[model samples]
Target: MIRFENVSVTYEDATETALHHVDAHIPEGELCLLVGPSGVGKSTLLGTVSGLVPHFTGGTLRGRVTVAGRDTRTHKPRELADVVGTVGQDPLAHFVTDTVEDELAYGMESLGLPPGTMRRRVEETLDLLGLNELRDRPIATLSGGQQQRVAIGSVLTPHPRVLVLDEPTSALDPGAAEEVLAVLQRLVHDLGTTVLMAEHRLERVVQYADQVLLLPSPGAPARLGDPAELMAVSPVRPPVVELGALADWSPLPLSVRDARRRAAPLRARLEGRTPPAAPAPAPEAPVLAQTARLTLLRERVTALHEVTLALRAGETVALMGRNGAGKSTLLGSLVGLHAPTSGSVSVGGAAPHRTRPAELLRHAGLVPQEPRDLLYADTVARECSSADRDAGAEPGTCRALVSELLPGIPDGTHPRDLSEGQRLALALAIVLTAGPPLLLLDEPTRGLDYAAKSRLVALLRDLAARGHGTVLATHDVELAAEVAHRVVILAQGEIVADGPTGEIVTSSPAFAPQTSKILAPEPWLTVPQVREAL
Candidate 1:
């Protein structure tokens, strides 16, 4: 069992304690979920189990953290490595080896395991994770999902009694995310390994958690208990739970399947009432931007090849393809971050490359996939206001816009100190506050929970309603289906498919929705949508 006895943790160079006298226990062989809004010390709490908080990160640690009956303070990461395996938000950050086989063996080899044992464990993990086919492949060549699995497999090869994963699926598409989660579920059910995970996207994993730890805010204490109880008290509850609350159901459902099971009676009662009118069809989209014979050259890579497309106003366009299919590069080319090798790209009738970066802020705003790097401000409020003022926005309007985007952030908190999700939200707020006519978002929902994602979707929908043209490049097909009017698939630096979101997702095997793979023929994005659809 892992036990935290009144553990209060403060990072170096920070005034506030990330964890506050937190007492928690994660029993051996139990799946524990550490969940919270951005920057509530969930990651810190997980770090304690792996001896990373005070040992590796140089934090002020109080109280005792005991794992597998060993005091964590006495055990360094390598000393406790065999007992506890940790996977962080960016899986690629930890990799030291080139191939999948070497990665899995690295951990075991460090533990002084025999060559035979390492080889056997490596092969076992490869087969267990379905990486046998790609065992010899370079880590750089694997897809995001594949890389994440390899990371997990590498850690698990040590045969740790406890596995701690921090937002493992945040960077993956829903389909790929589901695949990773399935492997984790198998580890718990089959191997009886205690799985403790901290994630923002609760809707995807909440159903699998045996226990839930809900952290309210940064510097605040966390509450731990039953999943249902945690959800009941959580301010950032999933839409399915919210729908259950609205339906007045006792003991809210955690999964869509559970919600469906309970909604039969609720549906019968709701069927008695008159249903609301169908939503008006979205306005016919008109071309707002165009790329004619566009080409992008990135060192030795040809990111885009003679790509031609039109993005219409009031249209939500999603760019979908496997990683390295040049999704990020294509989006970069659109914003002049990567100047086109040949041909022209125009936004709102202005040439993309010719427009100054500051001038482009008036016509288009690009939210890069990795938004944390975009933030350099001291405080969240200041950060949000900085870009808007740079773009000549009114101070009041900028504040108003920031408040709308992140209602959770306090006024004076340091922007750099905010959690990854909150920082992403802050970056998006900075871009949106500029009030650009064309908005480009690359993987906007990477580290957000269902509540945050819904808020983002609603915000984007409102933006589209207000006539802003939004282009979202993402692996999230669910997000695409709900918000986008059209889906554009890019493969091998060329446009493979472009059409209506529903048509593209529902009909194409290569471009199908991930949510549909879980619960088919539903045509829904949220649990509420599923409930309503049925």
Candidate 2:
């Protein structure tokens, strides 16, 4: 069990407290979900459980925090490793070994468990997380979802009484995310493990939470209660919850099945009405980029096959697929991070791989899967300044854009200290400063909440309206449905389907959004679209 009494945290340089007088108790063997907007201290609260807040993070803790009756204020993360296991957003940052089996055993080895015990736990964890097939693969070689499972398995091997996860399923595809959530459910139901997780993709996990913790904003007291009660008032909500609210359903439905069961009348009301039409394809638009029979291989692995694609100005393409389906790889090829082993790729009439860095920025700008890769300055102010100089923009252009995208982020804040969503916003501002003809974003909504994601959707739409070609690789089906003009799906390094967004998503059960699933055969992909129809 975890308990926080008048707990508050303030970093060394921060003026505002990350958490404010948070008093909550998470019962043993229960799964508690921490929900909040971006930069609202969800991660800060999770860190307090494992004593990472004041101990390793160099912060000041105000009151008592205990895990399994041990005061976390007095104990360090290492001291509580036996009872508390924490997995952060970045799985690569947590790994100490090269392969899956070794990573799983590393934590136990550090805990000084006997070799026999460690070996048995490793095998058990691999099986529990369904990583048997990838047990021998290098951690770096696995897809984002596989790496996430490996990260969770590495911590689960220790068999800690309390498991703390931050954005555990953000990187996973729909099926893999369900597997991870099911694993958590089993841990709570069968193993009696206390699971505390923070995730932005509420549609995937809210239904499974035993209780919900809402941290509305920084310096605000937390709210803990039944999931339905909190979701009714929570600013950040999943599509199902939003739909329930729209229909005025009592005890807002948290899952798709429940919402569907209650949607019969609404379906009847919508029987004769048609959903809004998707954007018409622009057959006469100029081609801004093209890849002809592109093939890419890395470490004897075929990441992308001989694939041909084209992006026209004013088009927004959503590249979607399962984990390890080469979405990221395809994005990389577009930005010249990976040169095609065969065929050609052209953006703005030149090969991206052959163009210089500065010149490349003129033709295309990429916001990679890891947003921090594009950020290097010590402070946000300097990062903006550097972006301005590199792009030859007006002195305040980057800063202005940052303000528009991430509003309240302080200029003095360290880039590393910003939340994942904030960091992505800053990275996106830097890329947009260049005014490139083509834009590439991979998993842009990884840590963004509903509000931030809405702003992103609007920004992308604005860019598309300005005749910029945009390609986004993401697993967020709702996001793709809302923003993309076209949808392209890839599988096993080959293009499986490419067409208008409505056609590609509504036709496929696996790719359909929550609203589409609830309003079955209705051709609706979002809550807004359904609301418009009604």
> Candidate 1 regions off by >4 Å?
11-16, 97-102, 123-147, 216-221, 266-286, 292-308, 320-326, 337-345, 348-362, 377-389, 395-400, 407-416, 476-478, 489-534
lDDT of candidate 2 over 1-534, digit per residue (tens): 899899889999798888888899999999999999998899999999998898889889999999988999888888999999999988888999999999999998888899999889888888877899888889989887789899999999888999999999998888778888898999999989999999999999999999999998777789899999999999899999999998999999999999999999888888888777656447999898899999999879999998899999889999998888898888887778888899899988888888888888898899988899999899999999999999999998999988888789999999999988999999999999999988999899999999999999999888888888899998899999999999999999999999988899988877889999998877678999878877
Query: Candidate 2: minimum summed lDDT over ten consecutive residues — where?
Result: 273-282
- Compute the lDDT for candidate 1: 0.77
RMSD of each: 4.3, 1.3
Collision count of model 2? 0
10 residues in a row with least lDDT, candidate 1? 272-281
Score residue 247 of candidate 1 by CA lDDT: 73
lDDT of 1 by residue, 225-266 (tens): 999988988867765677778778779888877877766565
Q: Highest lDDT: give the candidate number.
A: 2
lDDT of 2 at 48: 93
Cα displacement (angstroms), candidate 2, residue 485, comes to 1.3
Q: Which pairs of residues collide in candidate 1?
A: none
